[model samples]
Target: MFTEAQLYSPVTRTGDGDVTVHLSTEHPGVHDPAYRARRNAIAACALEYTSGAPTPRIAYTEAEEQVWRTVSIELARKHRGLASAEVLAAARRLALPTDHIPQLDEISAALTPLTGFRYVPAAGLVPLREFFGSFADRIFHSTQYIRHHSAPLYTPEPDAIHEIIGHATQLASPRFAAIYEAAGAAVARLRTDAALKFLADVFWFSLEFGVLREHGEIRCYGAGLLSSYGEIDEFRRAELRPLDVFAMGTGVYDITHYQPILFCAESMSEIEDVIGAFFESMDDETPLRARHLPTHANVPVAQ
Candidate 1:
């Protein structure tokens, strides 16, 4: 998966409440003058926004709305059979608009009551510290831009669809929202970059692309897997291993394609007991603790 920062624009806020979001030209879609202007407009609107302030609405183009409808309709069907019950329940609670692109405010209205989580806008890449730390306050920094229209089903970076559809649904559940808050607390307590990176890796594997065994079948609970149209089907074919904290924190893998390896828990209760417990107890010593332990590929924890 892409590094956390690469998926969001870097945002800077001034003491006087002035905000500047610097969009990267690295993505070719951003090269379009019209798209760039739309992105900038949304970022500007976000700058003027404050907590409890009304979310700024973007006037989406017809092309963008069509993209939203296409992905929304297809992902809904795909999610029914593949997504975890937790994700499905949250999706029902959110009741996200399918016929048109939803404004960030609409998402916040649905999510805030359920889990105290709300969305904030980003231009391109949000710094890892601010990005993860915001979770402590139940805030999610998201990009307002849509993916390039040419390929609505795929985006090299996390777009509005990924951020809103994938993450917002996950955030809607109090159970999963608590994990996010715990992860944020973990980041706040860490003193070293390595420790933070380890946390990020753990999050990438578990929250972003994690899976769990439900009954006799393997199902996806991770946002990355839940939102993806293609990879969701391919994930079951990858190497599925038991959930291991050490392996997840230290594992190195390629992001240019579907993950060849994924960690799975026996059930949702196992997810809460094991992964949830890990998040609740982590501290500055976590890195040293992992390093001191034997190099085991996959250590089974009694679930």
Candidate 2:
């Protein structure tokens, strides 16, 4: 699993209450002072947010809007042919705007009626426990910053696009929402870091990058694949394997490239029965027991 630092810019607050988002050297916006300032401003909005208060609003720039518009349109087009039927249906029900970025409150309003899920803002990297544990209450912690404008189709970390488009749509689906809550409950029950890490790895493999066979064609439901403009196009080419909890929980993967391996569920029912049930039943001893299982010896290592 990728560390939080590897997946998001770090946010720091000054003694005077100013916020800064430190982009890595390789981040697309690292050299752009204006973009850096925009990130800092957005991060500050999130930092100031309080629970039960209205979600913060961002007045996105035209460049950011254009990036949202471009990627939204392109991803919508791809979703027709590549996304799972369930995801497509959820997308329709959520009916997110494609012409401009929507605020977190707007997404929450849409989702709450459909699946009782709502959005909360995150400055940057949320602690893993807080992040996953929120799901138990049907809450998702999201970042508000848009990706660097230079690459309309790319982002090195989870931005508003990934949070809203990828996750919000999934949360709109009752089935997916239930799975998320189950995973979160499992996190709450876990006592050991190793077990927590194991659960997270299972979630990474299933919810973040999972796939399934629909109408004899492999279709993706994972948010990581659903939101990625490039990775979505390349996932079908990866090695496909049957859904196996032991394999998924212990498997190693790299986050910097298109996933080289994917787990496929026979149907959404299988996902609920296998992944959902696993999350609901897993505990601190689960990973320890998993390691002793014979199947653990065969967990695949990414090539």
Instruction: Please report the candidate that would top lDDT against the real structure.
Output: 2
Q: Each model's TM-score?
A: 0.88, 0.96
Every candidate's lDDT: 0.80, 0.90
- Please, what are the lDDT tens digits per residue for candidate 2 over residues 115-140? 99999999999988889999999999
What pairs collide in candidate 1? Answer: 8-124, 8-125, 8-126, 9-124, 9-125
Q: Report the lDDT of model 2 for residue 125.
A: 91
Model 1 TM-score, 2 decimals: 0.88
lDDT of 1 by residue, 1-303 (tens): 236665555666678755554556666566677766666666677666676776778889999999899998999998999888888999999899999988887888889999999887766676677888889999998778787687888876778888888999999899999999988877788788887788888889999998887767778988888777888888888788887787888888776589988888788788777677777778878867877766545543222
Query: By TM-score, how accurate is candidate 2?
Result: 0.96
The TM-score leader among the candidates is 2
Off by over 4 Å in 1: 8-31, 48-52, 294-303
lDDT for predicted candidate 1 compared with the true structure: 0.80
Which pairs of residues have clashing backbones in candidate 2? none
